[model samples]
Target: MDFSLTNEQELFQQMIRDFAENEVKPLAAEVDDLERFPIETVEKMAKIGIMGIPIPKQYGGAGGNNLMYAMAVEELSVVCATTGVIVSAHTSLCAAPILENGTEAQKQKYLPKLASGEWVGAFGLTEPNAGTDAAGQQTIAVEDGDNYIINGSKIFITNAEFAHVYVIFAMTDKSKGTRGISAFIIEKDTPGFSIGKKEKKMGIRGSATCELIFENVVIPKENLLGKLHKGFGIAMKTLDGGRIGIAAQALGIAQGAISETVKYVKERKQFGRPISGFQNTQFQLADMNTKTEASRMLVRKAANKKDKKLPYSVDAAMAKLYAAETAMEVTNKAVQLHGGYGYTREYPVERMMRDAKITEIYEGTSEVQRMVISANMLK
Candidate 1:
């Protein structure tokens, strides 16, 4: 099988890398310090077609492939994890389901706006009680003629405050358990739909995680995504793709840490010699870069499977598990190599360490990924 990127893909990567370095990188520290979303920088990303990297051109997007999208996320993540997630969530979670399952009219209505960056997108599957147990959806949707009245809350929702559109899930028939759940397309301005408490996160603070409260919110019946009572499948499938994005994000975070750590080691002296000259430091850098390379390959393998329309859930699980763990490991070492400076915000390593952590927790936890891989392997 071919493992090399096409020329077009390479160009896309280079262009995005340049943009991230020049634009998003400048704001990374400020965004984290202020805990504010960098709307201006995101607008710049959108204008450059980075926001819709994997979307087809017919839908107001750049008409890129998933692997290219992964590369783009990785490049942005190398500088700003928040920017990486913002693009990742928009493409993988929100736009993907609609593109894959929506009716022609639904696609015509939503995809262009999301792709054009006229509106950012969000997915709402997690609740206070439902995280890895996505089936335990307490949110209920009652049919009312041409409208569905939705009442539920989603916690830890990314892009909740700034998103104009959301893909949400709720129980239509509780007795049926997971099968009874259904997904919907809900607008932020819908009556009874409001933002709840904003979370102060430990990392990727600019990504905007918040509680999404829907109290008797009414939406058109036309907004029902996929088949009714079949949204549990949609939610699971959406995450299969989402995991690839998170893995790419993790891989990028690790790459960033190693690049910084290598520089620090060479310049940092111990025992009257450069730290890089020490065998111990050499081995540490070797391990960090080796793990990062492995993570990149896994992420790309998953992306390739996805792009080829092959079964990719298992590949995605493996990629996310390995890459996220690698991110945590590599970033931890980066801080250690930086010594006292790593412990303080004066260095990027400290911030990167914090950012590296969430990759393991969100999307699917490392434990959840193992379960997915094991289940698939057993099957």
Candidate 2:
């Protein structure tokens, strides 16, 4: 199997890396400090087609494959996790479902604007009560003549406040449990749709997560995505793609931490020599590099599977689980390697360590990933 990136993919990766370093990285600290969304940078990303990496060209996307998308995400995430997630949620969670399952009219109505970043997109699967237990969603959508009245609240919704479109899951038949769920594409200006409080998150502060409340919101019947009572499968399939992006994000964070730690160790002197001369520091760096590379390989393997249209659910889960945990571990070590300086906001590693924690929590937790992998093995 070929391990090398095609020239086009390599060029795409370099372009993103250059953009991140020159544009996103310099502003990252300010964005994190103010907890403000970088709309200008996001627009730039969209204009450059990074926002729609995996989407089809006919839909105004980059016409790229999953591996290329992962590479772009990793490059952005290396500088700013917030930017990374914004693009990921839009491309992976929001647009992907509509592209994969929506009817022609649905795709025509949503994909172009979302893919071009004319409007942001969000996914609403996690309700206040249903996170990992998404099948237990209490949000309800009742069918009416030519429309559906949705009434429920979704919490921790990424990009909810700024998004112009949302793909939401609601229970249409409680008796069917998971099968009872249905998906809808709701525009932001729909009647009775409103934004709730924005969450003050611990990290990825620039990515706006908020509560989305639908109070008897009415949407056209044509807005339904996929067949009735099939949203659970759609949600899970979207997440399968999302997991790969999350793993790429984790890989980026780990790479950033390792790069920074190496610089610090070489420059900071201790005991009449550079810290790099110390055996402990050397060993720490070695371990971090090794683990990060391993995580990267896992992510690439999963992305390859996705590109080939092979079964990748287990690979995606493993990559996300291991890479996210590795990010946490590597960032922790990076902070330690920085000694007292690491704890201070003066260092990027501190922020990186904070950013790394969420990867393990979202896109299926580490525990959930293990279950997915194990279950797939038994099949």
Instruction: Judge candidate 1 at residue 296 and give its lDDT.
Output: 94
Which regions of candidate 2 are displaced past 4 Å?
none
lDDT of 1 at 355: 97
User: Lowest-scoring 10 consecutive residues by lDDT in candidate 2?
Assistant: 1-10
**Candidate 2 global TM-score:** 0.99
In candidate 2, what are the lDDT values of residues 52-110, reduced to their tens digit?
Answer: 78889898887888998888888888888888888889888999999999999988888
* Candidate 2 C-alpha error for residue 290, in Å: 1.2
Q: Estimate each model's TM-score.
A: 0.99, 0.99
Cα lDDT computed for each candidate against the true fold: 0.92, 0.91
